[model samples]
Target chain A: MKELYNLGLSEIDIKNIIETYPEIKDLTDEEIAKNIEILKNINCNDKHIRNILIANPYYLNRSINDIKSLIMKLKEINIVNINLLFDSNPFLLNRDSYEIDEYIKKELEEGKKLEIIVDELESNPYIIDEK
Target chain B: MIVDELKRYMLEYGFNNEDINKILAVYTFKENEILFFNIKKINTLLETLGYTQNDIVKMAKRFPLLYSYSMKNIKQKIKDMQKLGYSYNDVIKIIKQLPAIYGYSIEENIKQKIKDMLELGYSYNDIIKMTKQLPSIYSYSIENIKQKIELYRLMNISHILVEKATYLMQSCELSFARYMFYKNKGIIIDENNYPKLFIDQLKFKRLYGIDNKTLIQMYNYDEYFSKEKNVLIKI
Candidate 1:
């Protein structure tokens, strides 16, 4: 818990993160520190960062550069609520970014707002059914 | 393998290839995903019990939750229900009417519910009768059940009100929003009247002086700090 605090996780964030992924209870303090660093590097807010971490605990293990590039792609496609996007579907990280990029383009073409598209994507990352 | 079998099973249930593909695409149930619960095992059990493919499709579609449920948990629930003197027929009826209950942990969730019902001054037979009267009873969490019960008790609502109209207790966002809206207006629901104060959308509009969409917005917003935000919204 102290390690999580040192990593800048608020009490509520730590509580919710643990609640969402109890398996993270066994994560070493070093692993948690790494997760904090990866999230902070992406300029994610504490709450939003917690949402991302809770949704995809594996992000803790991923190279910071991998997550950094994916987040950049998501931003370029106008995902207003990047945290919500991850919170809605953690598997977004595992899925092919090219497929997600194409889906975002289609949604944009349909005249949907960035927030709406992000909200829908959060719930249905495979809305385009990109296999 | 499980996905293939599920697709085949859905096809056997008369689902078109398009329907099968759509459902499989939306619901993530790959072969490795069913490690905790074998889909084939439930299929065999349900088939042996004489449930047609149509029945399974209806149950699966309406509830949209089966792959996550373990056969062991479901069997344990059946065993628990039988111990309570409910026949297998009764259990089937319960599941058919409300499939979501099939996923609830019998030992943890349902046991706590039965305990809450008992605490609410309902007898064992009365509880069974309540279940029959309202299939929605199984859908509520025990905490929400207790919260509503506490609020009802505060407002002097009778146990019979809860016993008869099960919806009076279930607290979804819309329901809770409506509750706050009406309560603020000092609109006390007539416990004796069916659709007493809140029947349909029209009644909601008439009583609350708000449109359905706005009411839905309020409901949606309650996903945050409900009690506090509701007061702010009302003001």
Candidate 2:
């Protein structure tokens, strides 16, 4: 909780985060610290981490193994800017790796280039869910 | 600087980069030139007209061309719709549903469409309600709309149902073909299963053992091409 305050989340931000994902209120300070450490392991700076928490507070409730595997899957696809991708579309972090791979394959089958797909997924990850 | 400002404004309003690229395909920003239109002013005008941020986003997404129109043109378009007895909220609803309404002309397209619908035995109130339901009806040609209504009459589907399911006005040939198929199958398509008329072509084929091409030719051959007496049919 002190770390979230250190990240500069306002009272309203904290309140809204708790209201949206009430389980955060039940997590221990150490568990919250572990999640933040996992986010930093993915190269998210403090500001990017703050934006992710605000955009989708459910990330705080995600298990460390689930978060690590999702990051690894995204990295396997050569997504270089995982920080910006998750910061903009944190909900995408919840997607299974197979779903992501299938979306890429479907787009490639439709004659889209790999580079364009990766860039699109990074900037506008919503297109993956549209598949 | 104006180009950057415009890009920033569009991004803030939730227009994705792909949407911006599509818009840029139609309009370009010249270097070292003052812009003639202002997207910011247009956003302010729409907000002033009681459109919420999401409504404006949805409308612009539907018709990115609206961003290219000058503020004066957009304002006049809204006022013209208002003059037609549509309240501000009603106009907003129409625009949200059919943002291409911004591109239509007052004298030739909008008013003429309403007048044509009135001449087609639809009361003014009916026209209003129907347009509110399906503003794309404003863009449908009079001949095409008449063909749709006539097909509904032939199907024994009431104009009231057409008003409720205005999408029935979509493809006349497709509707006629579906109607004939239902007739041949001794199946009645009332309000209950009118939606089945628009089933996917693959599903329709799998269910009825008839594809779209065969169905159109089987039933709609004479009526579909009767307009061109000497034209060679190429199905």
Candidate 3:
């Protein structure tokens, strides 16, 4: 662990990352390293990793259940247009994880049908299911 | 002083216009008065001042009355006091003491002298030249002449240099004189013994952060033409 810590991944870096993304505060050093490795394999730079962690709290926290549930919900919605979702919630276009409760409430207030709202939410990459 | 006593003597001897003016010609170095005398244009002057040839002749005969009256009516009576070689200070003093003698104040009288000098085929440069030589005519000193020349020269030189020269000249710094020679083609010091570029050179050195010692050094190296030597550094 100490050797891993010495590989340019200091305790300070972990602390800063956890503070910036509070949902990842409980993640162990190994989990954080694994997440960074996955992001690195995808050719993500420091800025991209920071941005991704900032946008996707569930990924930073290593919540597999949350990721699975979000995928299932997206498959059920069957969204055909990604642009419509981006137009509705531009924040979702860049990030892969975010709270969808407020968007749901806004859809309900606008009297949008549940299926239409679901389709819009599924098109957004950032929105995920709580279940 | 001799001219004043001669004037008194002319009054005492009852010398006419021709005689008194002839004596004036002998005593004064001004060519204009001599020109006036040679041309017999004294009559024209008398006529313009509302005096006749007979009146001038009569006044010349009674020098005390003529002198008294001339002093009283110097401005209104004389169209060309300058032609008579009246110094600016003398003209001003006479104007101030004998306000009834001239229709204008001392300053206005000086301006008129300047105007008349200009009209007499004198260029602005020539007038400035004369003014510098005879600042006593305008009640100015060498410093005053230098300041006026600097102001007039600023119209041609860069504003930055002009400002520098003005500061140095006004402060009576000798280095400013040297700077003037280097900043531009040496401005001809007017007849008044005032340096033309005095103000501009002083201003240039001051604004550009060139010290007086460095400017003096640059001035000293007239034969040397190197960039390193010209460049001024702060100590």
TM-score of chain A of each: 0.51, 0.88, 0.39
Instruction: Tell me the TM-score for chain B of model 3.
Output: 0.22
For model 2, the superposed segments whose C-alpha errors exceed 4 Å read A1-131, B29-33, B188-207, B211-214, B221-225, B228-235
Q: Which prediction has more favorable TM-score, 1 or 3?
A: 1
- Residue B56 of model 3 has an lDDT of 51
Instruction: Write model 2 residue lDDT over A1-131, tens digit each, in one string.
Output: 78789887777556655644555687788888898998888767665677667545656766677678778888887775566466545556554455566678988999998866875664344456434
Cα-based RMSD of the predictions, in order?
Answer: 10.8, 21.7, 43.5
Backbone clashes for every candidate come to: 0, 0, 18
Best-to-worst ranking by DockQ: 1, 2, 3
Candidate 1 docking category? incorrect
TM-score of chain B of each: 0.67, 0.80, 0.22
Whole-model alpha-carbon lDDT for candidate 2: 0.65
Tens-place lDDT per residue, model 3, B115-229, is 6545534455555445443332232222223433444343333223222322221221223434355445544444343443333333545665664445544554223323353
- Between candidates 1 and 3, name the one with more favorable lDDT: 1
Better of 2 and 3 by TM-score: 2
Query: What 10-residue stretch in candidate 3 chain A is worst by lDDT?
Result: A87-96
lDDT leaderboard ranking: 2, 1, 3
**Best-matching candidate per TM-score:** 2
Model 3 interface DockQ: 0.00
Q: Which residue ranges in model 1 land beyond 4 Å of their true spot?
A: A1-131, B1-9, B16-41, B62-73, B169-188, B206-209, B212-235
Cα lDDT of model 1 by residue, B1-235, tens digit: 7656666766876666654543454334354345314545765666666566666655554433444456676777677777766788887777765555665555555665687878977677877777765554554433344545554554455465445645442233334555556666676544554244335444555665775446646555235433432232321
